[model samples]
Target: MQPWETRLEEFIAQQYGLSFDTLTKAIGKGPRAASKLAQRLKKTGRAEVARVDCGSPGPWRNSANFDDPGEVPHGPLWIFSERPIAWGYLEFDPGEWRPKASTTAHLTAVTELRLALTGLDTDPRVWTSERLLRRRLKSETGRVEVHIHDAWVRDFTDADKVWAVEVELSRKFGEGRLARALSAALDAADRSELAGVLYFVRGAGLRRAVEVAATRLAHQRDVDHLPNLEIHDLDITLAQKGMRS
Candidate 1:
């Protein structure tokens, strides 16, 4: 296998999957170069790369506005092939499909994913976006439980400094959901080497709600051992970072 092919496989294996734009950035190449490499790897017959179609049609209007070419029917993300590759990695079989994502939710997730990519430009650590993060965390937890966070990031400077990132669009959390989220945070913090949990919410109302809920839970002596919870307004922060431009 070629060196770029091996790097592509490692990148996909680490992040689970990534869009063409992010892949380009991760590999320090232009879109055309990255696309060609992806194509060549698939053509090798030794790689098992699969495209994940982003089927949302609105809420962001132009799905391809963000560095995606208009060629692909649905803006797609590529994951390493499920079959084993030239590197002698074991076969990776994907599981049953989950329910479809709503246009709004999917768009919001894509925005968050882009913001995560922006972070990679400066941060030396690695980022595991959404579904991949869920899958990896599930496996880490014995494959019997589900993770609730949107992403998990590790600081390159400190391998022990791991952060669980959650991007909330507009879901109203009741007491039950809040309790479960808190419990999940506490359990993960206690059992793992997590440094903190970060919540990137869409609005001030949601941010305040999360802050209040997490604060209340943290104040409880029983749950005081949870990781530090930090909340930020997603849209405002993204704008401040000039990512929207």
Candidate 2:
């Protein structure tokens, strides 16, 4: 395993509540790279390596519960659902879990603000439901889930204007995965409802990869199908702006 890859694997295993084996599999690397990745992660001090149980079923398939429709109750604001949405429940370190709440809140606020600014009726109630935002994307390997936030304004005196937003925050994943996610979001949108795609990145080096992917995806579309793609660096300034007025 490459040093960075090992570091990433260890970091994810500790930070994201993923098992070492699971991390290795998700990372798709051999033993040497995986070992190196784990070692590198140890050096970062952002994560720790331990012999953890692989656990039962994967969180994506098992812990997610969607059968019961519920309203958004006030709390940490991890998710705000207008309606009940499916999600997985997994064990995570309380320390590492802190960022999850803030990240979700920031994204929710951005979605709402963008919609309002575009003159679309803003509904915080609907923001919690993943079902309304998530769609399946076709890929050579399989379908991947991509969440989309779309807004538009209709003028009584003029033609309607529209915009589409796509946000991705990935860790230890490759550009190919991000590309698949973006492609899925675009494919799911109605051409008439889309104005552009905003791609957000959180990991190192992945931003450049996403840029390339966005370019390639842009080429695949016709003049009308092509949505404006903009990449933003994830930083504290942007996060604070999204969170506070």
Candidate 3:
């Protein structure tokens, strides 16, 4: 791979997804540079690129109006790439477009990943969303599947910290899913698969709730414990960093 192509691939793989503008700024490329690079990557079999439009529209939206899906359809300019590039169609209905929490969570993850790489001087060799979802573990609690929204590794002074990051924009974690995630984190901690589990919540109430729930669960467990876990309000972090506007 060429130098610029390697940089682009590393950025995309670390951030999971990035918009056209972010790509341009990161690589110091012109407006059309990312598009041309992406096209070349796709044509040369070096990478796969796709545009995604997210969120559920209002009730008036109809699925039939959506363009037929086969290859990744042309949509908003938000570009996503995966390592080994998972190729397929991403379909969405046209409706009253509004930002969704899931979509924002992903963007927030990308931001955090960038912060870690730059501020912590960590390598950009982290797992993306697709790779994180593909990881699973077997424990005495049964088969624990990892659904970590995002994860990455950071280099500390002495040790490398593997962090499993969870961006919670809403308090809508179902009981089963929350339980499974808790189990998986505990398993990862116990087996030294991860260095820590971090939760970035949108509100103080949600942060407190997560802390209480995790504390209660920890009290009930004897064999496995979560010692390297942290919950922070996402809004506060953004404000502190002047990232909120």
Better of 1 and 3 by TM-score: 1
Residues 1-245, model 1: lDDT tens digits: 76655655654543445555556655767777777766666576644444444564322223232235654444354435433441233233444332223333443454345444444332224665554555456665457365555566775577768777766777565655865675576557556567777667777777777777776776675676345677777777766765444
| Candidate with the greatest lDDT versus the true structure | 1
Candidate 1 runs further than 4 Å off: 1-5, 46-79, 86-142, 146-161, 167-172, 203-205, 219-227, 233-244
Query: What lDDT would candidate 2 get against the real structure?
Result: 0.40
In order of appearance, the predictions have TM-scores of 0.60, 0.37, 0.58
Model 2 lDDT, residue 214, Cα = 72
RMSD in angstroms, all models? 6.2, 17.9, 8.7
Q: Mind sharing the TM-score for model 2?
A: 0.37
Per-residue lDDT for 156 in model 2? Answer: 24
lDDT string for model 2 (68-184, tens) is: 244222232111111111111112122222224334434443443333333122232222112223222324564433444432223323344334544455533654676677776
TM-score result, candidate 1: 0.60
Worst 10 residues of 2 by lDDT: 77-86
**Candidate 3 residue pairs in clash (backbone atoms < 3 Å):** none
Best by TM-score: 1
